[model samples]
Every structure is written in structure tokens, then in C-alpha cells.
Target: MAYRQGVTELLRILASAVTALLVAAPSLAPAQSSQPVLEISGASFRPLPIAIAPPIAVGDEAAAADEIYEALTFDLQVSGLFEVVPRKAFLADPREPVGPEGIAWTRWSDVGAESLVKFEVTKGAQGPKASFKLYGIASQRLDLGSTLEGRRADARRIGHRFADELVKHFTKEPGAFSTRVAFVKRAKNSKEIWVADFDGRNAAPVTDRGGISLLPAWSPNGAELAFTFFKKSMEYPNGHPQLWKANLGNGRSSAFVGRGDLNSGASYSPDGSKVAFTLSTDGNPEIYVVNADGSGLKRITHSEGINASPSWSPDGKRIAFVSDRHGTPQIFVMDADGGNVERLTRQGNYNQTPAWSPRGDLIAFTARDERIVFDIFVVDVATKEVKRITQDQGQNEHPAWAPNGRMLMFSSDRGGKKSLWVSSADGNVQRKLGLADDGEYTDPAWGPFTK
Candidate 1:
């Protein structure tokens, strides 16, 4: 009966298009319709054929142009929607196009490209200026267009914005380009929290607490981060980790919820008004909810065993967490006020670290099988259907959702070293963050879109 009620509610929301609908403000047309994209029901979604010409440089800025080109190509390809045509197949010299009027649509169409995108980067005294145009090959009608400005060192930033706009034109949802992913990186014997560009290009430490700093959770605005800091102190000689918050603006941090006892994971509500965390002052770890200002503390879970990893639903109506109350750690969902408790993972004997998607369609978590190997799994909230997102990949855990809900960032030891990896929700394509960097990463939390 509960499953039926949930399914009916989901269908009603789906019929009205109540959720997963993004405004078309970034779309260059300014009036793009609210049509849907390929559903994520494991449908054989078609990738649009799009040829992107190498970005042209104004006044001999080849490196800048190339960097911009790379960023754009990566963004579109990783999106899992657009099929980027090879630049080697571009029949028209990108530089030959003085403007959109000079595009050789026939040549692009000959190469099987359904659409084409062109961009020009100009380095000026004010910094760098970028202009782009998207056009349909056969129709010859401009699908979208936009201009952006940024510093020469901000090539990746500008490119991400451009890619997001392009995605908006096609999917109506903004791409994950403008977002940042906060992760924990290890150096020597110390673990520090670091924040980087979504694609893991510009990475820098957010904390230098020396001994260890883990469990980084970003504020909804991405301007602040809450983490657990551990260090040697007179009272805690062995080391103790207490919850702390850091301001990304000035890199300044202050104690957040230092209960002077064992405290664990923290997550912000969708509206950033409340925080759900696991505390164990009563000798039994239980999930608790508190105001963002650290007030109105209340307990959400009364499980006798360990209860941790509270992931709040995007609507802030539910919380998905891990509990071993039934003798085995499993994924469970409960209301924000801790009512109508329901078990979500039935088959798996061990499932933990559940991260609810931003779109609220699925909850991704790590599950251990009979072999004692860990992998990622996603469960549909309405249908109670379970799908494996990772398998046999060397110990995949901690699946965090990008702000757009189109991609997931998780930690894995597939390459002999622990690092953060990104993939679509269905686990179709997986890649290492930063491509070549050899940094040990964990506890990745994707921040909100650009401020």
C-alpha cells in the first residue's frame, strides 16, 4: 500500500511535470519550450550528432583557444547526451568562418553532423571575450548563441559556462559545468579537504588542519563547507575529530558542532535551513536534525545499533540513511521528522552511505556483497526498484550527486590508489577526476552551481 501511494504521487508529479523541470533562462533563444529529454528509465537514448569547430583565437592566442576548446569538448562528451564530431573531420576550416554567416553547413552535414557549434576567443586588455553560435546543419536555423567574458586564466571557467548554456538548449537543465566538487585528499600522513572545479582542473585545499580533516559537506550556496577536523590536543592526545565549518571566501573556519564527543557525518537540507547529522553522545550513534545555526536539535532515528550517513531528499521531506538495527547495515528512508520509517534496500545485506539525487529520482549508496566487495547501487524512490551502478570495480564507495543530478562522483581504488571518479547515474561511463593527477581522494560532495 505504501509503494502504491508513492507510485501514485510520483505519477501525479510526473504528469504535471512538477519536478525535474528547469527554467530555460540560460537558453539563448530566451523562449525555448519545456519539452522533455530522454527519460532515465534505461531507455536507449540517442546522442545528437554535433560537430564543434576548434575555437578561434583573436590576435595569436593559440594556447588560450586550445584550452577553451578542450574544456568545451570534455563537458559535452561527458554529458552523455551529445555526440561530438571529430575536429579532424571538419570540412570547413574553423578560422575560415568569419562569422556564423560563413559556416559550411553542407560540409558538416556531409560528415554526418546534425548540428555545428563555433566559438571564438579574443584576448583583450579587459581580459578574454568568448562568442559562440549553435546551428542546425540541415535547417540552417540558429539553435542558440551567447557571449562570455573572463580572464585568460579562466579559460576553463568560460568554457564550462558555454557548455552549460549549450546543454540548457538541449536538455532544459543546466549542465554540471559551473559546479564544484569538494573532496578529501591525502598527503603524507595527513588528510585534508580540497575543493576543485567540477572536472577536477583547479584543485586547492580548503583546510590545512594538519593531522586529518574528513567528511566535507558543502553548504547549499557553495560558499561554506562543514567538515570533521582531527588533530592532537592536550585533551585529545590520540586525536579527535569535531565538526567544523569553513568559509570558502576567506578560508576561515570556526567550530560548528563540537559536542566534545564522537560526532559523525553532516548534511544540509535542500533549503539549507536544517542539518541532519549522526551523533553518539548517548553511546549509541543515532541520526539527529538541527537548525543550520546549530539550534533546535532533535533526534530522527532511534535505532539501537549504529545509524549514520543521513542524506536528505531534495524536497527536504525525507531522509535516507544507513542503520544496522536489523543486525546488518542496510539503507533506510524515513520522514524528515522521523516518521513512516521504511526499509529501502531489501536484497543487499550491507548497504551504506546513501546519497539522494538532486532530482530525487534515485538514492545512490555503497553495498557489500557476499564476497565482501563494495560497489555502488541506486534505488528508485517510487518503484522500490534497485539497480547496480558499479560492479567488480575495486571497492567503489561514497556516491555523491552533482548539482544537476545527471552525474555522480564516487571514490574507488580501481587503479591501486584511491581517487575520486565521475560517471553517469547509470554507471555507463567512468573516468578519473583530473585525468592524470595522482591524488588520493575521498568523501566527495558536489557543491551548488556558480554563485
Candidate 2:
């Protein structure tokens, strides 16, 4: 689609406050600790200042331990919750103070650190074991402790699990680090579905079909994905797009809806028992739903122009979709049973791709403002109050919400290259994820929380 374009500018932004290590001033004493100031109130959030000590090399595999060290550091940093103390300023050795009780709490206070995480990762015969010790600077006490065990190849997953724990301890909400993102990556001459870690690591192709793929949607169970795929040939010289589903675990891809003259935007229902998609078998695109098995087909919208991108509400009571029934693309909400239709987004004439947050509190979508720039915006489903997320930051589209509703990942051309960026759900603490390759990524879909 022409709507998909390369980003014209580069801009990196995050609203969460995180600062590096700072030595305590002369006025401070070893017994004194920093006050707890990190809290989330409404749309505003304050990043906490925290320090981490390197894990001691456990065996002859000290070099191997480096992977865990780097992965852990990257997870916490991208979390946008803490200002990590630089390694050069790390006053404490990873070997000493193995236990919190044997440590000098004043050292962190002296370095102006408010919170701390001291961990030891060891590769053993069984697997890798990471011992994490959490602390509060205000009291110089151990707040929590846990052990994570994973296979050697699971080093990154281990780090993500540990980072999420820290975020949970401080924010009272689960972190999004453990999740993954699925998107369309441009390869050679075609685009295909690809999935990567929350930090954009381990990116690999999910489909080998040499064609154009877009708008991936993960099933609520995270076991399958549905997306729009187009393969041009004599049968489809002009490109006939169809909706297809893939078994993410087994690498199976098959069309679920192609009878329509044009099929795209396949969104699974909250219950995972049915799917809502846009089908244009009648020469006019309209919203439709069918059983998970592709049976019990039912049309949800009747319009002359277009109605696509059907996003279901969390409760399964309603669906927020895009339609041009009013002359311009705008967001609309209708009952799950197809009744009581009402327009939800009133401000923008060019609004589309409405993604309802898992928490059911907000709906994020893309809109082209009067300035003729595409940006991301979120509307409170209850109050209908709209909030702008990305303004003048290259074309930002495809806002996908993390399962916890704490973060959102979208595709942007912030640096003149179309790549995925993750940000706090409220547009705070944004960071561009560096995927494995330089390939442009688009239409990211944040998957559900993994077990």
C-alpha cells in the first residue's frame, strides 16, 4: 500500500527518566539512602535510578558468561525504568558481597544509587542458573530474591525474565520484556512475516512464501498468527491479497480466507474461537467474522466504500474497526453481535488501524493530522479523549499493545529506515529496537505473554 513509506527523519525519544551512576555528595553519610520517588500516576511516569554489578565468572566459561551479562544489561536499559550505573563507576566487585547481608550498602549510597540488583550467573552441568538479589536504596535492605534456571541457549530469555521481575517489583505491574513482536520485514524483493524478541533479537522468517505479507495478528494463545499475504502471478497479476493463518509452533502457513475478491486484516477474537477480518467478495470491503475453522461466516458491516482493520475489545463485547462510511477513514465501534454502531474517533478524518489495548482502557490508532503527517494516537475508550503519541516523527503506524498494556511497539522511519520501536503505553520512554539485520520492518504485532 502507498500508505507504507520509508521514514523521512530520525528521532529517538523516551519519556521515562533514567540516569547513570553518581557519587554521593559530601553531605551524604553511608547510612543515608535515597528516597523512593518512582511512581506511575496517570500518564506521567518517573524512571528510577538503579545500579547493577557484573556477575562473577563462575567457571572456565567466563567468556560465555559475557552473553548473559550483555543480555541482562540490555534488557534493563530498554525497559525504560532505570538509569543503569555505568560499568566504569561500578565501585563494588561482582565477586565480593556475594550476599546482601555481607555487602556495604553505603557504597551504593555513596555512588548516588537508589536501587540495586546484584546477580550471579553460572553455567553448570544442568544449565544456567542466575541468582538475582533486589535491593532498595532508601533502607539499604534486600527487597526480594529469586533464582532463574534456563538452558545455555536460553540466555536471552533468562535476561528478559529477570528484567521483568525488576520492573514488577518497582512498578507494581508486569514488564513487557518477556514478550515478542511479529512484523513484516522487507527481504530482497519481497516482504514476509518475521518474529523477534521484545528487544528485536533472534529475528527469523516465519514464512518462506516469496511474496508480500503484511499486518500480522497473533492469536490470544500465542500459538498461531493471522496475516495478509499476496503472491503475484498469472493468477494474480494485479496482486490479489488474501488472509492466511500460520501455526507459529510448526511453521505451517495456509489460507483461511481467499474466496473474497480482496481479503486482509485478519484479527482473532478475544476468545480465540473466531476471527474478524475484512472481506471484499462483493466488490466492497466490509468487516466479517467466522469460526476459527472458517465456518459460520457472518458479515458485520454493510458499506459502499471500505471497512477494514477490525480489532476486538478485550471483553469481547465490542469491536473497534476502521471505516469510510462517513466519507473519510475514521475509527468506529460496534457491538460484537453487530449492533449499535458508533464512531469512536471524531477528530481526524484520516484515522485507521484501531488496536484496543489488552487492559481495555485505551485504543491506539494511526491518524494523519492537518499538517499532512502521519502519527500515532490513543483514545480512551470510555471518555473518548484522544492523546497524541507520535507527532512529526516520521510516519508512525501499526500500534500494537503488549499483553500487559504497559508498552506498545510500532513501526517508524525515525532514522530514515523503517524499523520497530517500543515505548511505554502512554508514549513515554520510547526506544528503537535494533533488530538483527538492516532490513526495514513494518506492521508489528505484539504477541501475548508467553508461559
**lDDT of all the models against the reference?**
0.82, 0.80
Summarize candidate 1's per-residue lDDT along 409-448 as a digit string, tens digits: 9999998888888887677778777733555888999999
Lowest summed lDDT over 10 consecutive residues: which window, candidate 1? Answer: 22-31
Model 2 is weakest, by summed lDDT over 10 consecutive residues, at 12-21
Which one wins on TM-score?
1
- Report how far residue 49 has shifted in candidate 1, in Å: 1.9
RMSD of 1: 12.7
Per-residue lDDT of candidate 2, residues 1-451 (tens digit): 3333322221111211211112222111222223343586555766677887777656654554566667777767656667777777867755665465566777777787887777776766667787777777666556667788777777777778888877776767888887888999996888999998888887878988887888999998999999888856697996789888999889999987886678888888888999999888878988999998788989988767898899999999999999898899999999987799988888978999899999998999999999888899999988999999887689898899988887888889978989999887667567888685568999999998768
Scored by lDDT, model 2 comes in at: 0.80
